[model samples]
Target: MNKVTKQNALRAHSWAGVFLSVLLFLVCLSGTIAVFHFEFERWEQPHIQEMESVTPATIEKAMDTFLTQNPQESHHLFVVFPTSDIPRLVVENDHSAYFADQEGNLIEKESVSFTEMLVDLHLYLNLPHSWGMILVSALGAILCTLIITGIVAHKRISRDAFKFRRGGNGQQSQIDLHNRFGLWASPFHMVIAITGVYFGLAMVVMAVVAQVNYGGDRQAVMDQIFTPDPILAPQVGKPEIGKAFAQMQTLAPEKTPLFLTVHEVGAPEQFIEIYAKAPNRMIYAESYRFDTQGNYVGVAGYEFGEWGKQLAWSVYRLHFGDFAGMTSKWLYFVLGIMMTMLCVSGMEIWLSKKGHPVLATRLWYSVVWGSVSALALTAITDMFYSGSLTVVFWCLMVVNTALTVAMKGLSKSVWLMISGISVLGLLVFYLIVHTTASVTIASLQLNIPMAVYVCWSLYRANTLLKRERMAPSAKAQSGSPAQQTPA
Candidate 1:
C-alpha cells in the first residue's frame, strides 16, 4: 500500500479499536476465565456426589424419579453424562436441574450462579440472547476489520517484530507491545474472529442462502445445513432412555456420550438425541437419534459428514480452545489474557497520542482495573447473596468506576492493591462459608491460581508504591526539569 493508504488504514484501525475497547475488553476477560466453565460449575457444588460413571439403568431411574417428582416439567428433559472434565451426572429440564448420585438418586439442585454469570457475560453480555449475540458477533466482524487495517498500517511490522524500546515517553513501549502482541497473535485473532461471528450470524447467513436457493424455506435451509429431525408417530409416556443409551454404545463405540436430550418430552412423538464426542476430532459432537421406543433413527453427520457441516460444528471448541484437555485450555487462557492486554494497550496508545488527558486516562484506568476489582467483589457477593448476580456484577463495575473517578483517579498501585484485596477477600470468604467441605480438586484448581494472583498483585503493587514514593525525592535532588520523568 502507498503511504497515504497506510496512514488511512492506521486511522481506521485506531478508530475501530477505540470504538470497541471497553466491550471487547470485557468479552475477552470473561471468555478467558470461562475456559473452565465446567470446573467452576463443579467448584460451585463441591459437596455433590461425583462419580466416574453411571449405568444406563441408573440414568433411566433418575429420569423416571425426576419426572415422578416434578410432573409439570415435561416440556423437555436432558441428562448430561459425566466426562473427564466434569464427573457429575446432571439431569435438568427448562427451569430446574439436579445432580444424580451413583445410586440414581437426585441429590441437590444444581447452582452455579457465578459460573453462569461469567459465561453469560462472555456469550451475551447479560442481555437477552437474541440481540446480545448479534451485537457480539458484529463486534467480531469489526475485530477482523481492525486486524486487517492494523497489519496494513504497520508498514514495517515484520522489521520491527522483535523491537522493544523502553525508558522513553512510555508511548514507544505501549506501541511496541501492542504491535508485538497483535503480530504474534494475528493467526489466533483471525481464527477467533471468524468463529466468533459464526455463532450468531450463522442463522442470518443461512436465511439469506435459503432465500436465494431454497425459496426462503428456512426448514429446508436447516435440513440442508444440519441433520433433519426424525419424524415419529405419537404414543408415549417416557422415552426409552436405557435402550437409547445401549444403542449409542453399540452404534458409536469410539465416541463418548456427552449428553442426551429428550425432544418434545412426554409427547407421543418424543425422541432422544445423544451427542457423543469423537476422539481426536474437533466437531462439537456427533449426534445419534432414537425414537421413544428406543428404535434407532439416524446420525447428525457432524463427524464423517460434509466438510462445511463439520467445520460449522467445530466452531465452539476451536474458538474456545476446548480441545486437547487442560493443556489447550491453559493455552487459550494465556492467549486470551494477552488478547485482553492487547485491547488495553491499544487504548493506551490512543491516550498517549492524545497527550494523556487526565480525565480520559483516569476513566480508562478505572474501567480497565475497576472491572477486575468488580468481578472479584461480585464473586465475593455471590457467596452470601443469592439474588441477581449479573446485576450485582455490573452494578459493582459502575460503582468501582465512579468511585475511582470521584477520587480523581487513584494511582495504578492503589487499584492493584484494591483488586488484590478483593480477590483475597473472596477466597477467605469462600473458605469460611464452605469450611472443610470446600477442599476439592475442582475448587482448588481455581482457588490456587487465585491465591497466587493475589500474592503477585500485592507484591507488584508494593513495588510500584515504593518506586512512586522515591520518584519525587530523586527529581528534587536533581533539581532540573530534564530530570523529571515523562508522563
Candidate 2:
C-alpha cells in the first residue's frame, strides 16, 4: 500500500508538472530577469543626474515643476529616490514619468521599461491585473503540489542525494539533473512557491474576506492589510518636503528613504509618505507617514511591525530573492534557470511516455524557445522602434509558431537553434546600439547578463543539435533485430 501510494504521488507530481509547464516557465524566467529591476531602470534612463542623496528642496521643486505643467489634472505623485542600482531620482504621475536632477531640474522623460514589463509577466503573465494575479497564484499552488508529491515519490531522497549521472540517454540524464536540483534546492524552491502563492492569492483572499465580513467594503479590507491610501480634498498650503526629511532622520536614521509619495497634491487631506529601507529588514521598505506640513506621523509598522504582518510583507523580497542583494539574486537567477529547465524536462519525460507525439513536442519547443527569442529580439528592436514591446513580443512568438508550422517535417530542435542564433544576433545588435553611448555601471549590469545568457543559449542550441544529429545513430546502435522480427 505504501509503495502504491508512492507511485500515485509520483504520477500526480508528473501530471501537475505537465499541466503547469508553460506558465511555470514564463513566471520563473521573468522573475529571474526581474532580479535586476533597479539596474534596468538605470539602463533605461541614464541621462538623469545621479547622486547619493537629493535634497528635500530638490524633490519639492521637481514636484512643483511637474504639477505646474498639468494644473487641471491632479494625479497621484510618486518620487523614486536613488538606490545603489538606480542612482537617480524619478517622479511618476498618471500620464508619464520624468527624471529630476540633484538641484531639482526636470530632466528628460523616462522611457517604457521592458524589464518591468518582464516583471509584470512573472507577476500576472501580462494579463489584466486581478485575473492574472489569481491565475499566477494558482500556478504557485500547483508548484507547491508538485513539491510535496515529488518528495513523497522520491522517498529515498537522502540515499540518492549524491546520485547524478552526466552522460546518459535523454530521460535518464534529465531525471538525474532534475533530482539533483530539485532535492538540493528544495527548501529555497519551497519558499519561493509559498511566497509566490501568497502574492498571487493575497488580493483575492482580501476581497473574499472583505465580502464576507466587511460587507464588501474593499477599502476597509485593504486598511486592515495595508495603510489606507490618503484621501484627497481641496487645500491652500504646500507640503514641506524638506521638513519631512528632517523628521524622518530622527525616526529612521538607520534607513534610507527609497521613495516619497504625495497622495493628493494641494488638498486638505493631502499626505506625504516615504518608503524607507533599513539595513537588514526583509520587508521591501517601511512607510513613514507625514502631514503636508512635514509633521511626522508614526511609522507604517512594517519595519517593526507584528510578526505576521512583517512576514506577510516580506513575500516580495523572498519571492524574488532580493533581500541579500546581488549575491542572492544571482543564486535565484541560477535556480530560476534550473526551475525552467525542470519544467521543460518534466514535460519532456511526460511526452516521451506518451510516445513523443511530434505535434506536442513541436508546439512545446516553439513556445519555450520561441518566447525566449522574442524577448531578446524585442530588446533589440526597442532601441529603434517606438512600438509596444508587449505587443511586439507576442507577435514575434506567433511568427515563430507560424514558422514552426510552415516547416513541414523538421525536428523541433530547429526552433531552438534559431532561438540561439536570434540571441547571438541580439547581443550584436545591443552592442551596436550602445557602442557610442556613455558607459555607466548600469550598462555593465545589463550587458554582462546578456553576454552570460548568449553563452547559455548557445550551449543549449548546440546540445539540441548534437542530440538531433546523433538520434539516428543511437537508434541504429540499439541492437534491435530487424531480421528476427519475421520469426
Candidate 3:
C-alpha cells in the first residue's frame, strides 16, 4: 500500500476507535453477561414449587383458574408448561405470568430478571422505544468504520497475523496484543458487528420504510411481512382452545407451542395464532394460525421472500446466538469478552498517543473502570437486595459514574483496589450464605456458578495489582547506576 494511504487509514482508525470505544465496551460486556439470562431467571426464583411432569390437563386447569381470577380482562390467555430446567407451570392473563404450586395454587408473581434487563440495556441502553435502537445502531456503524479502518491501518498484516510480542515496552506490548486479538478474531468481530447493527438499526429502517411506502403505518408493514390471511367470522360457533391446540400438535408435532394469542378473543372473527419453538432454525419461531372454531388456517412464511426481509427476520437469532444452544452461547460469550477488551485496549492506545493530556487519561480511566465497578456492584446488589432490581441498577450506575468523575486524578489504583475488594467480599459472603442456608438444589446450582466466576475475577484482579505494584520497584532497581554498570 502507498504511504499516504496507510497514514490516512491509521489516522481514521485511531479517531474512530477513540470515538466508539467506551460505548462498544458497554455493549459487549452486557451482551456477554446476557448469554445466560434464562439460567439467571431460574436462579432468582428457586423457591417456586417444581414438578417433574406437566400435562396438558394440568396446564388447562391452571389456565381455567387464572382466567376465572381475571374475568374482567378480555384478552388471550397463555400457559407455559413446566420443563426440566424450570419446573413450574406459569400462567399468564395478559399483563404478567405467575408461578403455581404443584396443586395449581398461586405461589408468587414472577419478577423481571437482572440478566434480561442487562440484555435490554445492551441492545437499547434502556431508552424509550425506537430512539434507543437508533442510538445503538449509530454505535454499530461507528464500530464498522473502526473495523474497516483498523484493517487498512495494519500495513504488515500478514507478518503480524499471529505475532504477540511479550515483555516489550508498554506501547509495543499493547500494540502487539491489540493486533494479535484483532487478527485472530476478525471473523467473530465481523459477525458481532453486523449482527449487532442489524438488531439496533432494524426498527429505524423499518420505520423509515413504513413511513415512505406504507404511509407511516409500521404495523401495516409488520402485518404484510409476518401475518397470514385474516380469519373469517364464524357464522354461529364458539372458539375451542383445546381443538385448536390439538390441530397445532398434529401439524407441528416436533415443535412445542411456546405461547398462543387469540386476536379479538370471544368474537366471531377471533383467530388463534400459536407460536412454536424451532429446534434448529435461525428464524425466531414458526407461527401457525387457526380460526375461532379451531379450524386449521395456515403457516406464516418467511423462507421464500425478498432477501432484505428474510435477512432482517434472521438477524434476531443471529444477534442473540439463540438459534444455537449452549455451545453457540459459549462461543458468543468468548467473542464478546474479546470485543470488550478490544474496546478497552483501543482507548488505551489513544491515551498512549503523544501530546495527549492527563484529563483524557482520567476520563478514560473513569469510564472504563467505572463501568467495570458498576457491573460488579450490580451483580452484588441483585443477589442481596430484593425490592426493585431496575431501580437498584440505575442507582448503582449513577453512583459509580459520579464517584469516578468526582475522584478523577486521585489515584485510579486505589479505586480499582476498592472495587476488587468489594466484589471479592460480596461473592464470598454470598457463597457462605447459600451454603449455610437451607436452599433448594436449583438455587444452589445457580449461585455456585456465579460465585466461582466472581472468585476467579477477584484472583485475577489481585494478581494484576501485585504485578503492577512490583513493576516500578523492579524498573527503579534495574535502572540504578551500580546495577546498570554491572549489567
Candidate 4:
C-alpha cells in the first residue's frame, strides 16, 4: 500500500486499539484463569476423598440420610452426583449443601471456591445477573474490533508473522512479541471471541427474538427450545425419587446421570428431568424425563432436535473448553494466555505512543503481576481455609487494586522489580504448600501444567525487570515524561 493508505490504516488501528485495549485485556486475563475453575474447586475441598464410582444405590442412601436430617426440606432436595473431575457426592437442601464421601457422610458445607469466584468475575464481573452479563457482552464486541483492527495494522503480515526478535530496539521488541503471539494465537482468539460474544449476547439475542417472534414472552422461546410438552398430568401422589432413579437407569443404560431436577414438586404436573451424559457424544449432556410416579416420559429434544437447538445447547461445552477433555482444555488455556498478552501488549503499545506515563505503567504492572499473584494466593488460601472463597478473592482484589493505585506514578523499575520478586516467591511457596495437600492424581495432573506456566511467567517478568534496571537511559530515551522529567 502507498504511504497515505498505510497512514490511514495505522490511524484507524490506533484509534480502535486505544478504545478497547483495557477491556480486552481484562476479558482475556479473566478467561485464562477461568479455564481451571473445576480444578480449583477440587483443590478447595481437599478432604473430600475420591471414589471410583458412585452407584445409584449409594446416591439413594445419601439422599435418604440427608432427608432424615432435614425432613421439612426433603421435597426440595437436589443431589449432584460426583463425576471423574470431582469425586464426591454433593447433596443440597434449598439454600445449603455439603459434599460427602461414597458412604454418605458429610464432608464440607457448600462454600464457593476462589477459582470459581474468578470464573464468575471473569464472565460477569460479579455483578448482579442482569447488568453484569450485558457489560461482559459489550466487552466481547470491543474484542472483536481489536482483532479486526490489529490485522489491518500489520502491513507485511506474512513476512513478520512468526518473527520473535530476542534482542532488539524497544519498539521492534514490542512489535515482534505482538506479531508472534497475535498470529500464532489468531484462530484460538477468534474462537474465544465468538464464544465469549455468544455467551454475553445470548440473553440479549433471546430477548430480541422473544420480543419480535414470541410477543415478548421469552419463556415461550426457551420452552420451544429446551422443554418438552407436558404429558397428561399424572394423578397427584407422593413421588419416589428412588423409582425414578431406577427407571432412568433402565432407559439410559449407556448414559450416566449428572443431576435430577424435580419440577413443581407436589403438584400433579410435577415431573423429574434427569440430565445424563451422552454415552459417545461431544455435545451437551442430554435430558430424560419421567413423571412423579416414575413412569418414563420422553427424551428432551435438543439432543435429537433441529439444527438451531443443537447448536445453542452445545455453546456452553464449546465455549468453556469442556467438550473434549484435557487436550482441549490445554489448548484453550494457552490461547487464553496469548489473548491476555494481546490485551496487555495492546495497552502498552498505545501508552508507548502517547508517552508511557508512570501511572499507566504501574497499573499495567499491578494488573498483569497482581493477577498472577492473586491466583497463587487464592490457590494457597483454598488449601487451608474453610470460610468463603468469594470473600477471600474480593479482599485480595481490593488489596491489589489499592496497592496499584497507591503505587502509581512511582518508579516503573521499582514496581516491576517488586512485582516480579513477589510472583516468583509466591509460586515457590504455593508449590511447597500444595505438595502437602491430599490431592488426587487427576487433580495433580491438571495442576502440573498450570504450575509450569506460572513459573515461566514469573521468570519472564523477572528477566524483563532485570533488563529494565540495567538500562536507565533506555527509559529516558523512550520519551516518557515520568522517566525524563526531574524531581
Model 1: lDDT of residue 29: 86
Ranked by TM-score, the better of candidates 2 and 3 is 2
In lDDT terms, how accurate is model 2? 0.78
State the displacement of the C-alpha of residue 301, model 3, in Å, after optimal TM-score superposition: 2.2
Residues 355-451, model 4: lDDT tens digits? 8876667776676666566656765676578776667766876787687777543344444444445545554655576555635664466456655
User: Could you say which candidate leads in lDDT?
Assistant: 1
Global lDDT scores for all candidate models: 0.87, 0.78, 0.70, 0.70
Output the lDDT of residue 247, model 1. 80
How do the residues 65-165 of candidate 2 rate in per-residue lDDT, one tens digit apiece? Answer: 97776465654678888877577888877677888888888888888568767778888998998789889888988988988888889868778888876
Question: What C-alpha lDDT, on a 0 to 100 scale, does residue 299 get in candidate 1?
Answer: 86
Ten contiguous residues with the weakest lDDT in model 3: 409-418
TM-score of 3: 0.85
Residue 170 Cα positional deviation in candidate 2, in Å, after optimal superposition: 3.0
Model 2 TM-score on a 0 to 1 scale: 0.91
List pairs with backbone clashes in candidate 4.
Answer: none
Compute each candidate's TM-score over C-alphas: 0.95, 0.91, 0.85, 0.85
- How far residue 168's Cα lies from its native spot in candidate 1, in Å, is 2.5
